[model samples]
Target: MKLFRQVFLSIAAMLAVQGASAADARLPVVASFSILGDIVANIGGDRIVVTTLVGPDQDAHVFQPAPDHIKSVARARLVVVNGLGFEGWMERVTQSANYRGDIVVASQGIAVRDRVEEEHDHDSHDGHDHHHGKNDPHAWQNPANIVIYTQNIVAALSKLDPAGAALYRKNGDAYIASLNELDRWAIQQFAQFPPAKRKVITSHDAFEYFGAHYQVRFLAPQGVSTESEPSAKEVAGLIRQIRKEKIRAVFIENMSSPKLLQQISKEAGVTLGGKLYADALSQADGPAPTYLKLMRYNIGQLLAQMKLN
Candidate 1:
């Protein structure tokens, strides 16, 4: 009878533990787009259900939220964003929907890069500059900026779920370490091309951070957002620049249609280096699923096709 009672107590304790574990499950989350989704997944893991407002292959720069998107946001306990004016419509939509959840600005305290007209020569993407805030919103293009993202995520998640604080910190640390290693690799790979050959033109000015960090010169036909289709005159002007500068490659941005870029490539007589992930992360099965992987894949392809003869 004593042995049986001990066994019964052990079984009861195990059941109690399981019940408590289920009760402690975390809240539902919603990320503005793919990159945020990836970062949240890296930390949220199995603790929370995460839904992306704009997923991979979708253009967040021009994402018009649907009824389902609003429903998801309303149901979310937390919403992560890349703040700095990247998603202009986010604030209004969330406010309109009365979302009272934690809105985490992933790039909260990171040092912003200069994006004034004088800073860059190309006047192609002018008049559309949304450089109102402290820094450029394309912080994800520079891996160093990701440190701020990870930390902000850790703090936000901890505030929302104190019990999972340690787990969130651990995941952020691991992911940041991986991003640091990627920074080194980017420097090395980008070094392969001589300074003169480091120039490439694209459909949009989404690569300012990438160019600034890797010493590459990026000329965008359109403005910052992919939604801004350049006028025919602008395309002709870019074609002239490509011919005069003998630019190595014209890259197609993942978020934008390749049709416009193809036209530029054909007119300029330059090769389309590769597709660059300008605004969002790649699909789970694609090459640029994670932020780090996206950077490496983009830089590698650029180098391979843009290397000077």
Candidate 2:
């Protein structure tokens, strides 16, 4: 009996050591939001464990980080952010956590679009600078920009985890290929319609990159950030544009309030088309759970509504 007990104890100890080693092997990473988290997970694969500060279907513009987020950041070896002034609260969170790690800006090398330019192009006549002349942080709306994001992530991951450099490169290349394919698909899809029929309206001005990439005109009542509400004049101007343009494709963003869009649709005499995943992604059980899925789902929604227009 003593010999059998000793053999079992040795096996258990070996199993525990193996489990701990496996756990220790994975590098801990913290992403600013769900969309970025999904992208990091695709590139990092099983080599890293990711914790997202803003979860799926949540608005990052009004996000309030808690103690758990600080703890996650503190434990992470690397922190990833979208970094076009997207996460206004990120600085405070990182400082409070005392995180001493590499911070990766995923949108680092992309061609940035200015909010003022977007406002002018979209025919926003509100005369209000919603973003205060800041750059649009929704670069991920364009698949081409996400290619840059993927490359940046790969470089950051490779630099931190030298042992996993080859794996990161391989994964990043695959993701970039997928992104290219998605962009090509989008171009072809949008090309089928005339430029006049490529106009859409959503709750917020989050699709400027997307609009520029596919040559679609996206009109919105609110500005880049969901925190910025549209004034009465701004809302009236958008309603007039919708009526004048005969635009029937109206959508509500998954992360934004539907009330404003509902009111716009009612005043403009257009039915609410559907929900588009803009700043954040949907839950795992819903349509968009991953970055790729989010893009595809949003494209599908826009196309369906644009068909009516």
Candidate 3:
């Protein structure tokens, strides 16, 4: 009986040690927003635990950090952010949190474009301003941009947890392949539409990357940034342009309030392409809950609304 008790105690002790080692192996990562968190979750898998600074469907453009967010940041082993001035509130939060982890800027390798004059002005925005998103904080609008985001995440994770480097690389390669497949698939699906009818009217100027990549036109009331709202004059002008160009399907952005766009649509006699995932992901079980689902939802909506007439 004495020997059996000792044996049982030995087994329990070993189990406790094993649990501690497993816990140590897992990284505690913090992402600035939901989309970044999802990307981290995909590549990190079981190797890392990710926490999103901004919850689902929350606009990172206007996000303000809370006490809990600071605590999350301070606890993180690595911090991943969209950068390109998308999360204006993050720097202050990180400073307050006094975090010492490596900060990963996900947009490092993306090719950025300038915003249009009517919807944006060079002097109107500077670094660390949401308006700086004039270059399109909606980089995920084009899947190819996500390749760079994945690469940054992989590099940062590898640096923070070298043991999991191989897994991160392998996962990133697989995800990139899937993105490439989606890109080709999008091209093929869009080929069904005529070129003259390829033009689109979105609530904001958020789809230029998608337009450029897929050979479609994205006409917008606001410029390339969802952070900006147009004046009534601008709306009137856009309405006139929509009629003049015979634009089809004005889309409502997932992150922006749809009131202005809906009013414009009413006056213009154009259908509102409901709920596009622009600057953020939707809450799960909603439309565009995931990146894959977001793309599919947007494309499906566009297809349903777009007409050759």
Candidate 4:
């Protein structure tokens, strides 16, 4: 009985050591927001563990990092950001955390779109401070751009974890395939609607890439950044434009305040369309939990409303 007990104890100790070693093998990665978190998770699979500073349904525009976020960055082996001046606080957070890891700019290789200053400047009144950068940061709206994002992520992950390079590339290729399919479907869906009926209004200008790619036009009261609040004059002007164009596809973003859009819809004599996932993803139980589902849901909502237009 004593010999049997000793053998069992030795076996248990070996198993515990193996388990801890396996746990230690997982690379710690941090992403700026939930959308990127999901993408990184897909690429990393079981090889890396990911933490997101900005969670689902939270706006990254005005995200204030807490102590936990600082700790997350400090411990991360790799950090990823959208990098079109999207997360203005990211530099501050990384500085505070004193993170020394490699930082990956997910949108690094994509063709950037400059924010049309004249269009926004005309709408914004005096004393209105525009907070967004010169270029639009919502590149994930275009799946083609996400292809670039996926490639960057794969390259970053593989560099950090040479052993998992094959797996990361495999996952990235599969994701890019899905993105291509999504792009094709989006093109077909938008092609069914006439150009005149393709205009839409939302809480913010987060869909310019989507608009440009799919030939749909999106007008918003607020600028690219949700932090930029429109003046009464700007809101009135948008209301007038909505009326002039007879645009009925007015929608609110998941991460933005609906007060402005609600007011616009009521004053414009048009019913408010359903919520659209713009900068952030919805909760796991919601319609846009995944990146793929988010685009599909937004497209469905837009089409349903554009049919009325």
Q: List clash counts for every candidate, in order.
A: 0, 0, 0, 0
Report the lDDT tens digits of candidate 4 across residue range 1-309.
999999999999999999999888899999999999999999999998899999999999999899999999999999999999999999999999998999999999899997753233334456353444479999999999999999999999999889999999999999999999999998999889999999899998899899989999888998889999888877887888788889999999999999989988999999999999998899999999989999999999999999999
Best by TM-score: 2
Q: Residue 228 of model 1: what lDDT?
A: 73
The best candidate in terms of lDDT: 4
Better of 2 and 3 by TM-score: 2
Residue 167, model 1: lDDT of 87
Report how far off residue 239 is in candidate 2 (Å): 0.8
lDDT of 4 at 265: 95
Candidate 2's residue-wise lDDT over 76-181, tens digit each? Answer: 9999999999999999999999989999999998999987532322355565545557789999999998889999999999999999999999999999999999
Point out the higher-scoring one by lDDT: 1 or 2: 2
**Clash count, predicted structure 4:** 0
* Positional deviation of residue 174's Cα in model 4 after best superposition, in angstroms: 0.5
Error of 1 at 241 (Å): 1.2
Ranking by TM-score: 2, 4, 3, 1
Taken over the whole model, the C-alpha lDDT of each candidate is: 0.81, 0.90, 0.80, 0.91
What TM-score do all the candidates reach, one by one?
Answer: 0.85, 0.93, 0.86, 0.92
- Which residue pairs of candidate 4 clash? none
Candidate order (lDDT): 4, 2, 1, 3
